[model samples]
Structure formats: C-alpha cells, structure tokens
Target: MAFQCQRDCYMKEFVTTVVSCCPAELKHEVNGKKETLKGFNVKLQDTILFPEGGGQPDDHGLIADVPVIRVTRQGPEAIHFVASPLAVGQEVQVKVNWERRFDHMQQHSGQHLLTALADTMFGFKTTSWDLGRQRSVIELDTPCMKPAQLQGLEEAVNEKIRAHVPVTVQLLSIDDPAVEKVRSRGLPEDHAGPIRIIDIEGIDANMCCGTHVSNLSHLQVIKLLGIEKGKKNKTNLIFLAGNRVLKYAEKSYSTERAMVSILKTGPDEHVEAVDKLQKSVKLLQKTNLSLLRDMAVLIAKNFENNPQKGNFFSLHKKEGDNEFMNIIANEINTEETLVFLTVGEDKGPGLFLLAGPSRSVAEMGPWVLKMLKGKGAGKNGRFQGKANSLAQRAEVEVFLQQHCKHQTSEEE
Candidate 1:
C-alpha cells in the first residue's frame, strides 16, 4: 500500500481563533477567490473587530502573525479574513495595530461629540455619518446653518475635547433597564437587539455601534472643515480628527513653503505678496494693450499712404486676436473706406474682422462668414469671424470684393 500525504485533508481543517485574544491570529486559505481578503472565515471567541457598519470602517491589523487582510460585517459578527493558514485548535498570539485602531476611535468619538453638541446647542440631530480615510462627515437633520452658528458649534466641540472628558462604553441588552437612559434622537427603541451606549460624562450620551477611545483626550484635536447645505433639511459637516489633523497641518505647511519660494516673500507677507503680483499682472496687461493700439495706429497710417485701390482693402498680419485687427479697422473706418482686416498665421489659425462705411460690405458680411466657415454677426456695418487659417482670410476677402461689386452693379 502506498503512503498518502494528508495535505488536502489538513488544508480543509485549518482554522485561526478570532475573539479569544486582544489581537487574534486569523488563518485564511488563498485559492484565487475574493481580493483584499474578503469572504475569508474567522474563529472569533466573542470578537471585538469593529465591522464595516454604522458608517465606520472595520478594524484592520494582523491576526496571529498573519495579516487580518480585511474585516467585514456579515449579519451580526465581524468576520476577519487572514492570509496564511493556521492549525485547528492551535493557540496563537493576536496583535491589533493600535495606531489605526486609535485613529478610528478618535474619529468615531469626535463624531459623537459633534453630534451631541449639535443636539444640545442647535436642536439638530445627526442623521448619518461617512468616515473616509482623510476626512469624516456627519449629516444633520437640519439643512442650513449660518457660518457664525457653525463656528460656535465647532468651538464648543473642541472645548469638550480639551476638557478630556471620559468616554464610557456600556453594553446592554434590549431588556436592560439602563437602556432607557441611553437617549439618541435618531435611533428607534425597537431597532435592534443588544445596544451599546457611549457616554461622555456630563456632556453626551448616545447609542452607537462603533468603537471609540476611552476618553476625549485621545482625540487630541478636532478640526471642522465646513458645513454645507445638503438635501432638504439636512446639513453636511466635514471634519478631521487625530493624525488626520496633523497630516493636514503638514501638507498646509509644505504648500506655504512652496508658495513662499515662488512668491519671493516671507511667511508674514505671503498674502500681500500674492496681492502685489496680481496688481502687477493687471498693470502689465493695460500697458500691453496701449502698445498694441499705438501699433495699430501706425499700421493704419501706412495702409492709407499705400492705399490698395478697390472697393475693399485687405491686410493680414501676425497678431494675437481680433482686438488688434478690430482696432486698426476702426481707425481706418473713420475715413470713407471699406477695410477687410485678417490678422494671424497664413498656415495656421487666425481671426477676421471687416469694418467699412459701405452697405455692400454689410450685405456681403453673411456670405464672407459662410465662405470662411466661421461664426459672427454683422449690424451697423461691422462684422467679425474666427478664421481657420490665413488662406481662409484671403478667400473671404476675394468673396467679399466680388459680392460687393455685384451688389453695386445690381443697384446701379
């Protein structure tokens, strides 16, 4: 009889304890299934892994040396999936990443603080919450709030954080008499089974399903991002907590440092420096326009001296936009002459403008616009079009000259 290896049999029985330890090692089997460790099983002995529920992300860390790849809620229990397999009934030390856990705790507690403050100060109740990686948002029942009112509420929450109030977590059954003391404006009495209530001594007491820190001091700092009007009768508040606040501060400092270097000013003068740069830009733009106008005057004088005899005089120059060409056309239009000015590259894109003191140019304006494949309207003997190329400008000029002559002949 050939001896057979029990690898397949052993693989089926692999298990890791879930809730017996503080940081339980979760054994998982990988066979090309769900990514990010989802759908994996856990052997929790009354697990405390906060599942992804109640607008809070599941706690993440290593379990029994293997990474607790993902924690998700299925029904009631928080299931933790791990990477490597473990022996059934094997005792392994568990380790939870306290930093990640603590950050979540701060955010969760900060939310409670804010919600409690909202209810007490402004008669508003938090309806929902979204805990993001960088920011946390709480949606309130009231849709609108003045900036001054939001500022006051933020100041009040920060004061509580500074006070270092203890946050006590109590687990109670639905029938427990103490459950009556747990008052939340949003939660219904018959909503669920056993409920967990978080109490901030003398400040707040509310029913919550998320994990929180032991005290308000753990939150360290709470920064309000803003409050915006949301869907009917709901106001959304964005905030930052714990290390997120520090991270924001670090990023802001980096931005200020870069701005200081670019603006060539000290930290104190950064605002003033930016203001000065804006004013300088405006003055430079005005000076440039004045110079363009002077150049247009010069070009018109030269055109007058070397007049192109005909009903239409055409000129094309390398210019920025229609502004310069329009200026030159207006200067020449003062005389009883019709001018078709097209300014830009002959091989590339350009602008077209026709200003003349004749009804022929005005009548032929629509035809020229169509020939150039550009858009504009003419009224009171002035027309303009955005030309695709300087070649199109020449085409338009020829079309205008022929049309004007034809119309003059017809009138005669």
Candidate 2:
C-alpha cells in the first residue's frame, strides 16, 4: 500500500457508506501460520472506521459481515481491507466496531483531561502522547515527578471525570483569532489545514486530530499508573482508563494472590518473608562451601602419603565444584602428579579439570577432550575444560593411565 495514491475521497461518513472496491491480496501471518487473505481495498464515499494516525491505532470492524481487518487513510480516502472482494460501484453497509471505538474514545479523552490537569496543577506541559491497547502514556516536559504530586494530579483528574464536563470540538481556520486562544503542542511546519480544537468545558481547549468522547463521564475513570524516566529530562506518565483500569487491577490481584500462596505467607508478610528466606539461603550456601573445603583437605592428605595414587588420579563425581578440585590440586605435587577430575549431575557438557607436568597436562586434555567431544584451555601444567558425555569418563581414565605409565618409563 503506497502512501502517495491520489484517488482520494474527502467525504467523511459517520455510519454507512456506498463504496467502490478493487481486489487486493494480503499475505500475512496469524497465530504463527502464514495465510493469504482474499480481500479488497474498498474506497467509500465516507467511512466510520478511523484510519490509524496521530499516535492512535487504527479502528477495526466488519464491512457487511466480512471482517475489515485493517483500515488506512491514503491521502483523503479511508481504505477498508475487507475479507472478500466487493464488486466495483457496489454499495455496502459499513458498521463501526462500537466497543473498540468507545474504548479508544475513553482513553484518548482521559489523556486530554489528565494532560490538562498536569499542566494546570503542576506547570508540566505534555510533550507527546500514545494511545495503546491496554494503556496510554503522555510524555511530560519535566526532569522528575514527586509521588505526592502524582497522587494530587490523579485526584484532581478524577474529580473532573466525576464532574461530567462537556467536550466540544471546533474547526477554525489557521488565521482565526480564536485559534490563538487554543493550547497546541505546536503547529506543524507543513500544516495548512484548519485547526481542530477539542474543548473540555472550562478546563482546557487544545488542538488535536484524534477522536474523543463528548463528555468526561464517558471516561468512567482515569488512573495514573506511574512515571518512567525518559530522554534527558522528560517523564513519561503511564495511565489506564475505564475497563482497562479494572482489567489491570483484576490481573494484579490474581498475581498477588498466587505469589502469597507460593511464598507461604500472607500479603502483609510477603516482603519480609522473602527477605528473610534469601538471607537464610545465603547462610546455608556458606556452610555447604565450608564442608566441601574440609572434604577436599582430607582427600588431599590421603594423596600426600600415597603419591603413586595421586600420580595418575582421575575422579568423576556426580556433583563437584571447580574450586574444590583446585583446592585438592594445591595440596598435591602439581609438577609430577597428573589429576583429571570431572563433575556433573545428570547431563552432557560436564565441567572438567586436568593438571600435571606440562607435557602430560597438554597431552591429557587433548586426548580426553577428543574422547568426550569437548573443549578446554590450559597453561603451566593446568587445564580446565568441559566433557560432553559422562559415558566417556572410563575411556579418558584408561587413556591417561596408559600415557602416564609410558611417560614414566621414558623418563627412567
């Protein structure tokens, strides 16, 4: 779909429209399945579906019971992407998705109210805004925001929502005197069209191009979630409105309940419980490491008396730490003793360490690594690597024993 199409229709329809159409194939993925939608790009005399623009998403609905998946504005005309093709010059019933439309209206109008309130109550100007599906955001020109200030602004905005302030729209030429009175982010550099001003009773009047509810009451409610740090000094305020706020609250409550049950604590004690549990875990890990170190010292003393056993040592265990293995090596004569150790619980790619006289150390790692189909690094008679399979442990031990004996005989 090109943006520069010139066959534009300017008449904007509110409810239904007779439209001419042309067949267009759309290839896209749905739910991870690629499929082709046999549809037509229908150009109507007018359309109720608002085309995506100005940070707001496009409206979706059916055109004569066939789903209109997408709508885009090509120049002045509203292009409806319908499921099946319609004959050229055929008049079709176009129904707007009122539920989705109303939701957008609530969110967009709620944003204007919130933005205006922020500006008036705290002197923060709205830099930009986005209308999302679940929530909306407004970027405020401020370095930081106080929690108390946010609470105050939220309370003030809800008060206006309860006031049921009437929202009015006015279209004025750029040169009109009243245009000067409207609050706008700024006029676009290429803008030549008349300004569309949205007025919220006595609260505010700002120039905007998006759809909005006619009354503040229609917003149901406005919630300021929080602020996110934005570029340099700007703050982006997250918010939700109407049904979305209720939905978010419901999901949050459900998640909190799950967390409480899993933590085995009530909501009031969850934070304290988690902190205490973390401290206990740290203490237990420290104790376990001390035990492993004691075991390493005992094993190393046994090797000191019987250096022959340590000369060609190979130990493969279900769970061992590299630090524990290195501690054992530190107690042995690393210049003469060759040590091959491996550790794993129940899987491939297990941790391994090899150390001995330089010649033996270099030969041991490459042969054992090849047998296990793994990789490693070594220097100064110490090599650390990973084994791909536990089944190769026996083969690695036999190969090391034979090579060590051959190397010993050659030295004699």
Give the Cα lDDT of each candidate. Answer: 0.71, 0.78
- State the lDDT at 225 in candidate 2: 92
Tell me the TM-score of each prediction against the true structure.
0.59, 0.75
lDDT of 1: 0.71
Clashing pairs in 1: 18-43, 18-44, 19-44, 19-45, 23-94, 25-63, 25-64, 143-233, 143-234
- Model 2 ranges off by over 4 Å: 1-45, 62-71, 79-102, 132-135, 186-194, 296-322, 332-334, 337-345, 348-352, 359-377, 385-412
Tens digits of per-residue lDDT, candidate 2, 1-412, equal 1111111111122434546778888776799998998878887676667777656677777666777888876665678887787666656666667678777777888888988889999999988898886779999999999999999998998898898899987778888999888888786464545677889999999887667778888888888999999887999999998888888889999988998889988888988998999999999999988998888778777877873573677776675788888988888787888888888854466888888899878766777778777788888899887777767777778888888888888888
Clash-forming residue pairs, model 2 = none
Please report how far candidate 2 places residue 3 from its true position, in Å: 16
